[model samples]
Target chain A: MPAGASTRAGSILAKPDHRYAAVSILPSVLVVFAVVIYPLIYAVMMSFRDSRMGVLGGFIGLANYARLFSDVEFRLAIVRTLVLTVIAVALVIVISLGVAMVVNERFRGSSFIKLALLLPYALPGTLSALIWRWMYDPSYGILNAVLYHTGFIKEYVTFTGDPRTAMGAIILAHVWKFVPYSAFLFVAGLSSIPPGLYEAARIDGASSLTIFRKITLPLLAPAMQLALIVQTVFAVLYHFGLVYIITGGGPGRATTTLPWYVYSETFRFMQFGRGSAAAVVLALIMLVFIYVYLVALSPKERTVS
Target chain B: MRRQDTISGRRRRKAVWLALMTVLIGMYLLFPLVWMALSSFQDERVLQSRPPRVLLTPDIFTLDHYNFLLTGRMPETGIMVQAMYTMSGTYVLPSVVNSLVIAVTVTLGNLILGIPAAHAFARVRFRGNRTLFMALFATRLLPALSIVVPMFIIVSRIGLLDTKLALMVIYLAITLPFTLWLLRGYFAHVPRELEEAARVDGAGRFTVLWRIVLPVAKPGLIASAVFAFMLSYGEFPFALILTQSLASRTMPALMAGIGYYGSSRGMVAAASVLSFAPPLVLAALFRRQLIDGLTQRFE
Candidate 1:
């Protein structure tokens, strides 16, 4: 059978014109190869050699990897990245799910709320951090003002300056920026559930909570899993802008996630070999993340296949 | 009758609660943008006030920040004296134009390549199609940091660093995968019978795609276009690393350079609002297409 032949085509599967298809597909393949695949291979190779400021040095197999493991800061950065990723992903899921349910109710003004929800994510991440930076300003932040005026605080607090609240502040900005996208995912998930299922449950005298638990929660799992996995990847790899702008990964290295570590190591410290090695570790970690997602999705995928 | 009345009453209460919840969430989502807009309008001195002016009276609100950004003229009262000194002859507007250039060019590049490739993948099955599809999407799996060093080295070697062409090439990499995947779904959604009918009328492959399939897939095409635009417009990492000057630096990097409303808080706020205007407006107007494109099932 011709590969990927449509069902409409008869049993006499004619061979596809590979030349035509290849010609049509070559430009995109080449672009991606030059920009994405080639760079990736280069990065992997660079991880094996000692380089300084993009100049190649002698091949030092796994030396950078060894240093990455032994380095105290890199270890701490890994721990911090894991902590942030877990907490941020969890918060994003819960908050987005809750908001999705509310919006799915389709109450009056829901459309306006939907429009408003896209703002944070749509605005550039750097600017969102800046906006939140103003909101979180210690002496003159609107957040402090509102809290003090509302009698929730006794004094002005440095939200991003204190190590205790720095990462929390960053997480809050992240949630603000990311929740909309995840909420949209949940909304899509909710929309996909067959209305007949809910109607059937209601006809069977199911309570609202029972209907949700039995009919909604199980059905929403795929989208929920997708959102969680994607957000986890983002938390690990992205959020560099938030970390860079708000705290500069500062207040004593309080917010230096893995991406930030790569940035500072390679760009600031000019340790190209070490940075490339760290980047490889990050890529490996991400592979594990994707592998988990794949493993989780495999059963569903197999059923469909 | 009494039970019926009670059930309606319960629904009314639920609706009321939902409305309340939506209002609270909307405020949480909107207040930051509102604050930025307000700060942009207020005088720099007014912004520094303790408890910063929440409601703008006519007196505190002025267009000085915007005027300065637009005209390059400093206010006589010298509210942003320090900012003016630092930002004199700054190419804020030109830089934003550079951003537009990169975003528009990259978006067009993506669609041109993405549409044909997606059509090929969806319609013409060939050897290695599945493998190529997997590889194309796999490119997006790794973090941008993983390849930034190599990409930088590659771009600089070609001597395209800090040029819009450099940005176009890098952003093409960033946006093409998503565009290809989404447009492939769009192409697949076009009923096969439509193309076959056109072919029966003697239309060639390209003409069938161009005439019959594309018209039907226009909404999806627009959605993918918007997505491509926004990705390049708001992308930060590559923008930060690959470009160093106004020669090619986009809004995100430029805004970051302003130090998050540090000293020139007012001007930066204005620039932020200005920078966000196009994508935000596009997003608002095309909300439906964007949402459908994102949340639509490919399968």
Candidate 2:
């Protein structure tokens, strides 16, 4: 809210029944606290105990944390997750920038294109993964049929069935769902770049490329920051639904990200302590990411204007 | 004349390039869903054939998939687990109903909890206001996996597992904070003069808010409602954890269960289409509102 609007609104609505205000706010406050704070503390405690098969055992004190370092599967899962996150985030930002750039221009059928882009963002990750899984199906998938028909390969290729393509498959699906959101944000960012600057640059004989590099890019920093934050959360940090649907961390754990590892550890391996420990570590890692991203993107991220 | 021609030529090339890119982006985004929709109508054998037919013809397509989904009659899917999948296929509509109920309940929960809370945050000056707002939304920043273990245990201990109530409660928590964010932004911006005018006419606070504020805040309400609905509808992990069967399972969970068993590609595609319909419709209808709400701060 602008300061003017808020102040104006506040002036008339001053002390609008503080009791009513508190009563209304209390439900959301209580829910958030009870649901989040309690579970978070419990997760911390479970990380210390030797819980297996959903059974709580004696306290094990940092053993679960220590084990995260030495366990090769866990280590590999972290590495795979980082690789996927880094690559996916890069693609999401760049592609969304391209998308936003194009969509910002009022060309024929641009409105349709804009709506098309948002369709994927609106689709569920699991459903999106299922669609891609069909596309990647070895014998029956359209991808294989297309590649074979086009003479890209002599034989149909196994996408998710093969270790090499599984990571790429999930990444593609993940990126597909993620890019539109950032694209829409970037379109807003692009239009928000006052048109006068563009006219001025044009009069000054700046090339399109130069104008983009100079005026457009710097101005897009806020949207870029937002895209980065959202992508990191959905693409790398929290989203396991895509992987869960498409691969289930299979084909030799080729697509196993850390989030998947948490599910795998708890359910498949039945090591609740380790899974909780992994969860705790994942939270800590997320904190570091939030910290670094905020610190790096800071002040600018807050001020959209 | 040559300089003018050169500049015109450059502009033409740029326009063509943009046009090409626009079409490609459209195809890239829409292809998978379109393919899934078209493929669902194909015969199982036709769908499974090596270098499967991409286009549908009268000879190739069948309504068996739709028949099985819309009605309880089994399609002639030759899998040995026909009985199982048929039973499971019947679950799709019911699970969809489950999703609708839960999502609707979650949306209502969001509005009921969100409106007043957002109003307070934006208007009512209180101690710890900013702090509470931040803390409420803090969980959104982290992965659900972090706290899901304890949440899972808590749900089970309370014996709410495999129940829709568990999902409804969790989703309310998950969605309310974000709804609060959007609604607060909205309520803060509602014109105060109208409410004051109502007050001058001798209306109470609740009545003023009801009569004056709500109508003005309708856009915010719609946006928040749609946001909560979409999130609740598409949510996966908790649905996977909490729901045991069609009794409380959502569309995504049911689809996942089918995928796990390696169900027929044609039928799975059919299931995907059925499941995608609701959100797809919602997205198509509320695309403007959803986008505007999400990018509210952008302007």
**Pick by TM-score: which candidate is best?**
1
Please give the C-alpha DockQ score of model 2: 0.59
Assess each prediction's global lDDT (C-alpha) against the native: 0.82, 0.81
Top DockQ model: 1
lDDT value, residue A18 of candidate 2: 60
Worst 10 residues of 2 chain B by lDDT: B77-86
The fnat scores of all predictions, in order, read 0.69, 0.68
Candidate 2: misplaced stretches above 4 Å? A1-17, A300-305, B1-8, B76-86, B196-204, B260-262, B297-299
lDDT over C-alpha atoms for residue B83 of model 1:
54
The TM-score of chain B in candidate 1 is 0.94
Candidate 1, residue A152: CA error in Å? Answer: 2.4
Per residue, candidate 1 scores C-alpha lDDT tens digits across A1-305 of 24464454543233333444666688999998788778778888999998877568999998989888999889998888888888999999989888888878776776777787778767878889889888898878899998999999999999999999999999988988889889888988898788888888998999999987988988987787778777987787668888888899898899888889988989998988888888888888888888887787644542110
Top lDDT hit: 1
For model 1, how does the per-residue alpha-carbon lDDT over B1-299 read when each residue is reduced to its tens digit? 99999999999999888888888898888999999998888877787788789888998887877887788877788645545424622666777788889899998999889888888888887667778887888777788888888878888888988888888888898789889888888889898999888877877677887888888998788888988898888888888898886646788887777744456677777878988997898898888887777666442
Q: Candidate 2's residue-wise lDDT over B35-97, tens digit each?
A: 999888888778767778878999988888777778877756565435434467778888888
